[model samples]
Structure formats: C-alpha cells, structure tokens
Target: MDRRRTLRQRLATQRLSAAPLPRAADVVRLLACVQSQERDHAFFSLGLRSRDTTYAAVRAAYDRGAFLRTHILRPTWHFVLPDDVRWILAATSPRVLRAMSYRHAQVGLDDPAHVTRSLDALGELLRGRAFLTRREIGAAFGERPGLPSAGEQLGHLLLLAELEGLVCSGPMKGVHHSYALLDEVVPPAPALGRDEALARLAHRFFAGHGPASLKDLARWASVTQADARAGVAATLAATPGALEEVEIDGITHWFDPSLPRRTTAGRAAHLLPVYDEAVLTYPAVNFPAAPGHPTGGAVDPFWEPVIVDETNAGLWRRTVGKDAVAVETRLATGLDHEQRALVLEAARRLADFLGRELDYREVTGGPAADDAKARRAAIG
Candidate 1:
C-alpha cells in the first residue's frame, strides 16, 4: 500500500473504532488495553465515570468473567477480561516491573526481603475486609507491630502488593475509594507460557489498535524496541494477514492492512476526560491539530472539552457564577460566518451532553473573556 494511503487508512480506523462502540460492555473490555492506575487520574478516565455509569460497566464485565483490578499494563490497576489478563500481564508486566525497579530502590524498597515483609503485613490487614481506601488502610498498618510511619509506608507497600497481584481498587463506594484482594475479587485464568503470552498480547494490540508499527506498540506498552519487534514478529507469524509497510517523511513503518476506516458521523462532539486513551495512545502523526494552536506542540493532554471541526478549533470548560460552560477557540485565522455557526452548533451539542443549558462566548477579535458579556447575550 502507498504510504500516504496507509496513513490515511490508520487515521480513519482510529476515528471510527477507537471510542466505545455499540455496547458499553465492549468498551469496558477494550478498557483493559489502556487503563493504568499508577499514572493517577488516567484510571478514572478509562471507565470510572459517574457512579451509575461506572458500576454498570464494571458489573457487566465482571459477571461475564472479565478480570478486574490487576497489574496488567503500565504496572497499574487495569480491568482486563479474565480470558485476556493472564497473557497480557505475563507479556507486559516484566517490562513495567523492571522499569519500576529503580523507583523501588528510591522508595527504600530495594531489597526483596523488605518487600516481602511489607506484603505480608498488608495481606494480613486486608484479609477479610471488602475494601479500604488507601488512607484507611494506612491507619490500620500504623497499629500493627514492627511497622513504622504506616501512612508513608503504605504507599510503597500498596505499590509492591499491586505489582505482585495481591491487591487492587475495588468497586467505587459512593465516591469513597476502596481496595480488595485479587484472589477474592478475580479468579485466575488459564496460564500461557512466556512465548505464547507475548505473541497473544502483540496480536491483541494490533487487532484492537492495528495499522500500528512496532515503535507505536513499544511506546504504548513502555517496552524496549527489541521486545516490541519480537512480539510483532511472533504475532505476524501466527496471523494470516500480510504486513504492509508505509513511509512518512522518509521513515518506514509497518501496519496491518485490514484495519477499519474512519467514519465521519457522530465524531464532531466529544467530552473526552483528561488523558483519554484515544488522544493519548496513538502516534502524534495521526491527529495533528490546526497549525498555530495556542496550547502549542500537540494538544494539552487534559480533560478540557474539545470542539473538533476541520481541526481542533477550540476548548471549553464548566464553572460556577458566569456561563456554566466557557469556550476558547484558538483559530488559525478568525472563523468566517459559516465556521462560527458550526462552532456554536458544536457548543450546543456539548451542552446537551452535559445535560445543562449551554451559555457560550466566541473568542473573536481577542481573548474569550474580553467579549464574555456579549457572548452570553448571544447565547441567550
């Protein structure tokens, strides 16, 4: 396939299939591919939306025997389906653990003996409890014998326990955080040998996010290029499809040819949380913003509500007092009358999604605040 044609095809696939599809269950299953708790709020962005939305998705996946709360990828809490988690962890966890070894040393957990002691203490404290927030768990540890500074120590201990598959964040309890034992929560899936595990994960990655090269896989998985190439080779050897090469700016990249194409419908308005995987996982070459965006080099990876037109023309936020939603557009040049109308329509769609009457102001001729009063009047 021609390089430009292939690149276009990949972008098309991502625009269509990258987001949650027909069923919420399928979305929850795909969440396994990218979720990571160690990176802080990224986990919440994965599937932990409102209490109702998150719980429904989790319960559905759990009932179907999908895995929950394991150190699958990026050495953090990812809710992999039971069938997929074992091989994913086997293929991906070693690299993440190795990367974290230096962090372990820095946190005064360099010795395996020390790590084991911490895990034992934690496991004992959490045995029968359904869940405890990190703070509550730390307080419990403070009362234990031979443990000091349990609050600070708890963080390191939890990291070790999570990496070892001993504990994970359980279902949300009305916004109060909680954690549970893995064995009690998710039964083990059948195990795969190392080679089989690696091959399986690579194939899943390509199937889920195909038309991607080894380097893209490496960056997403946080593994070395060598390991990524080996994984890709193993996957391609087993699969029937041919590997196609594409060149961008004179650099060659490999991708699967059968990847889906982008659909233009229903993609204009998105309330992407901060660090949504759609924006985070793919290569930068795929979704280049309009030239001269104020946020500069690539879009700021935050949960600002984005308005996508021919390009990412503006960003929006909600706050108290003034208009519930505020919009700021970094136009390459000022929007003509038609483009401005489209932008307002996009803003209205965003307001509908949030279930609030949207009050919006266009940042024309200057910063948005300069014309805030007029913009609100226009919306009214």
Candidate 2:
C-alpha cells in the first residue's frame, strides 16, 4: 500500500486537507466533538478548520452556545455541541468514569448519596445564575456541610455533574471557563436507546474520524473493543454503504465513502493543535518512515504536531508575548527547502488564527522523554 496516499486520504477526511468549512460551528458539528482541554488551543482547533476565522470570532460562537465544552469521549475536555452532549455522555461516561475510578476514589467522591447531594447542590446553584467559574462554584459548594468540595475533590464533583448531564460549559467569564446547569444551557434532549445511541456514536466516529479501525474507535471513545465492534457493525448494517472498508497490509479500516479518495494537489503542511483531530484522533497512524523505524513520536498530547506532507516531522510549542506569538519547532527530521517554507507558513496560520504577529524558531529534538512516559502512564 502507498502510505502517503493512505495518510493523505485520512487527512482530507479529517477536514485538515479538505476545503475549509465556512464557520467554526460547522467544523465542530462535522467532527462531532473536538478534544479541547487547552481553551486557547481548542479555539484554534476550530478556527483553523475554517477558511478564515479569528480567536475572537470562535470564542464568540462558543459563548453563544454553538458548542458546549465538557468531559466526554475518553475522560478529557471535548467541545461537543449542545445537540450532542446528552446522548454522547450517556453512551460514553460509564467507561470514562471507570477509567477515572482510581482518581474518583482518591478524591473520596464515589459515594452515591454524596454524589447526588453535590449534583443537586450544583444544579440549584447554577439554576440561580446564568454562569459561574469553577472556583466560584467550588467555593459555594464547599459551604455545603458534609460534602467533599475542595481542590481535586471539587474538580471531580464538577466532572461528575458534567457526566450526569447536570451541567455543561457556560459562557466564558473573563478568561476562565464557567459552568451552568445543562437545562438552562440547552433545551431538554430525550435520551437515545442503548443500541441506537451506540450506532449513532459509531456512525459519528467513523464518519468524522474514519479510515479508522475498531481499536481507534474503542481507544478514542473509551468504549470496550467489543462495544466498538458492535457499534461499527450496527452502523454499517443500519446505513449500508455509508462507510467503505479498505485493507492496508493486514489491517482493516473504514471511512466515509463519500469523502474524496485523493488529496488535493501539492505538498501541504499544517500547524495542528495539541490533541488535533488529524494528529490524535487515531492511534493506528503508520507514517512512511525509513525501514525498521518504529513510529512517529506523536502519543504525547502536550506537544502540538508539525505536519509536513502528511508526516509527523516534529512537535511544536507556542509562546504568546504581548505583540507576537512565537512558534518553535522541535524537529526529529530535517526539513527540505520546500518543507521549511511550508512549516513557516503553518506558523503564520497559527498567528493569523490568534490575530498576532508570527515569531518562528526551530530546534533539533522531540518532546522530553519523561513527559511522554509519565503522560502515557497517567492515561493507562
């Protein structure tokens, strides 16, 4: 199989190499839910998918409830739409909670009665106001007697409220994210049945992050591998020919058949955000490396990827100063003249999205080994 062709096809399907969407909201709806832990990077993740958009514009849409950021799809922050939040959480939160079980226990937050009280309190508190930051909510929640509501414990309780559909992302209060009752944020959404929910989720995953394997689905959604298989099967059976399967070596992958099979002409580079859909949505990406090379060093979500012609040639970090945003590249492989130009242009794209001047730099290394190791261990 031609690895370049496969990679390009997947990138195009991810909307990275496709014609840009008109608006940031369109981008989020297309991707189902985008990984968005870093608020700035999350805004860029949406803005970069559009033809031309600014951080202010994207944040405006978010404040308008175009999408609601919350804990979903594998126990991390994701920008899920209000239309999608309830069903997606219902389908995925159990496994995420299981993954978070140790941390939940560490915070002494697993008690059913205690959780109910916290949620009830949070719901009532948020119902009184349109929005409140985490710290604001935490302080008030701490006032309630016999409830664990401080530090990591408060954070977990908020996460629980999110998972239980009691609250979602509220309007940005200054620079900090706030939370409000889900009911006030969006109209009531009836829950979907288990099988139907699974099928809808599977369809969204494969359609949005397609040319992906069952393992990718399971890993990304924190569902069981078997659950992933069942969802994929049901989605395929329910909507015949929506997805097409292809075999590269011995691995089977599925993608939306309607998306272009060929990438647009010319070499391209993208300053993909940290936890970018193109970079982190799939664990099965096998880039065209030299013989016997293991894999691209991309599992670290902390380092944003520098994609040069569909290969992960490096990781990048950004430093925002008053006048300009400096983007520094830590390269594992040297870039040719064309690739160097592309990477510089990609840096410019980030600056444009952030509405700042570009200050670019380069170096010769990947992410710190200890950082990647500890992160992988933490997630595992």
Strongest candidate by lDDT: 2
Tens digits of per-residue lDDT, candidate 1, 1-380, equal 44345444543444432333444335445434645453223333434222223434444444444445555566555556645655666667777778888877876777777777767877776788557777777777677765534544557667667766687656555545467776666667778887766666666665555556677778777667787777667777877564555665565566556645554454344444454555556564444444444453345322243434434444544442333555444443433566656657765644443345677764432234544676577679
Residue 299, model 2: Cα distance from true site in angstroms: 5.1
**Per-residue C-alpha lDDT of model 2 across residues 1-380, encoded as one tens digit per residue:** 45677788877776677777888877888788898998888789888777547888999999889888998877889998889999999999887878888888788887888878877777788886559998887778678787665788888888878887888898899999999888887888888997888888888887777778888888888888888888878888998887788876578887888865566535677777877787677666655432211136535556666777667767788989878999987765556767778888889988988889999987655565666777878799
lDDT of each: 0.55, 0.79
Name the lDDT value of residue 278 in candidate 1: 51
Number of clashes found in candidate 2: 0
Candidate 2 residue 59 Cα shift, in angstroms, is 0.7
lDDT at 133, model 2:
91
Candidate 1 RMSD to the real structure: 6.8
Task: Candidate 1: give the clashing pairs.
Answer: 12-262, 67-81, 67-82, 274-303
